[model samples]
Target: MKKLLILISILISLQVQAQRTSAPEGPGSLTFWENLSKHCGKSFEGEMLNASENDQFYGKKLVMHVRTCEDGKITVPFHVGDDHSRTWVLTMEEGNLIKLKHDHRHEDGTEDRVTQYGGLSSNTGMAKVQFFPADQETTDLIPYAATNVWWITLDDTSFTYNLRRINNNSPIIVKFDLTKEVETPPTPWGWED
Candidate 1:
């Protein structure tokens, strides 16, 4: 009976450890990623909530397509007016953190000078929100953007992408309505069929 009791306790401990590691709704969980993934393969139209006076995206048609999703990564193409030069890549890292990278390309399918600039999340953000401060790569590529911080928030009704430059008080916010699905835009630059 003593041996059997010890085995049962060991099994219970292992079970608990597994649950702790795999629970989706646990503290600092991957619920944010799961929520974002729910919209995989869908496209949504967005309105600019805020932008600077000279911003390129001002007064333009905004669209975001959740183009690709895999086990640990998602690719979203962000369209502004007729420009299809930007893609957002979200990757899950160890410890439930997510990294956001901006992949920029020219129409000729060549990478832009300021491509692949983004940062990793500091912690497992909430189910509906994740924040990524500019990483060293971004700072090195775009010196003025060293103080940039970008965040994405997703909820049942809408999803928002926002950016703030700490050094200057510049802000840009775009919100996409989840209640409606828009037509998927053409493949982003460099992602042609």
Candidate 2:
């Protein structure tokens, strides 16, 4: 009877450990989405931390505005110097999944040729960070970006946006200071008020 009890205890311990390892961390992607939504209607200043000389945003002033936030969607406009052509649309899908899409527009309020390229969160990411691997739609929109994985990390002091491509050593990392709010820039191209 003693040996049987010991075996049962071990089995129970193993089962608890399995559950701990398999469960998503913190409140998963919903928590992350909520954390990000906390910055709605605010603007922040950022610097390109890993830009190469040839990078388009190398010498530009970077700004990001959490322009709109709704229950299931958030819209952020990323302004590079005088260019207000880039906007990020984040949508919460069913099952706690979040989709990130880039909305590029011309100065005349028309969609750019290379636009709406992004991905969906593959799993329940942590509360502070989430990874979005290139989806089939992203690959169809931009074949060369098939291996791109974009991640966003939000914390009390800073928010970071990063991108890495498989087999590439260099990554694009931009960090925005969340401690200080900046003046909201003009509306992004193709957006009103």
Best by lDDT: 2
lDDT of each: 0.83, 0.86
Backbone clashes counted, model 1: 0
**Top-TM-score structure, candidate number:** 2
Model 2 lDDT tens row, 25-127: 5556887788788999999999988788899999998999999998899999999999999999999988888899999999999999999999999987666
- After aligning candidate 2 to the native by TM-score, how far in Å is the CA of 9 from where it should be? 35
The per-residue C-alpha lDDT of model 1 at residue 165 equals 75
**Every model's TM-score:** 0.84, 0.85
lDDT of 1 at 99: 95
Model 2 ranges with Cα > 4 A deviation: 1-26
Candidate 2 RMSD to the correct structure: 10.6
lDDT of 1 by residue, 1-193 (tens): 4554475359446644655665555644387687788999899999987666588998889999999989899999999999999999999998888999999999998999889999999888666667899999999999888888788877688888888776444467889999999999999999854
lDDT of residue 31 for candidate 2: 74
Q: What is every candidate's alpha-carbon RMSD to the true fold?
A: 13.0, 10.6
